[model samples]
Target: MGGGGTLFTYINKSTSHLIIPFEIAFKYEEKGFKTADAFIAAYTEWVGADVLVTENRHFLACHLDLPFKVLTAGKCLNLI
Candidate 1:
């Protein structure tokens, strides 16, 4: 299989996939998050995730209230 197909298979088999509701995403948007960030945040909250990893400096610096922790990829790796 090609790399993309292989990656898709791995994700399909190994990940706990979910669909985030529009209301939840919209709530984040109202809280000042951009469209993509809103969905990401909504998914994190909906899933009850412990941490949300990202390299975006703005997201890292934001003081928004959220249930989960946010960390850089390096910081997440270090915790492993």
Candidate 2:
């Protein structure tokens, strides 16, 4: 869910899976990370995403509870 910037390969995918939050307050309450990261995790879970593509170190931390499989952007490139 992290490749929204490069519109070439992901616009349609995002549009199809978009999950707009009906409520934002306390939506993503994970600590030790940015609000965006927490929200991404929550939203990914809400939308039933199987994989989360990103290179963020914080997301890979062992202490985090990430529901989806986390892959580096480079790793996704290799897999594709």
Which candidate number would show the highest lDDT if scored against the true structure? 1
lDDT of each: 0.75, 0.63
Alpha carbon deviation, residue 12, candidate 1 (Å):
7.8
Give the residue spans of candidate 1 off by over 4 A. Answer: 1-17
lDDT of 1 by residue, 1-80 (tens): 55654311112322346667889999989988899988888877776666788887767999457887888989876865
| Clash pairs detected, candidate 1 | none
- Which of the numbered candidates is closest to the native, going by highest TM-score? 1
In terms of lDDT, model 2 sits at 0.63
Residues 1-80, candidate 2: write the lDDT tens digits: 46665422333466446655635314555345467776767666666677778777878765345566888888787866
Q: After aligning candidate 2 to the native by TM-score, how far in Å is the CA of 32 from where it should be?
A: 4.1
User: Positional deviation of 21 in candidate 1, in angstroms?
Assistant: 1.0
Number of clashes in every candidate structure? 0, 0
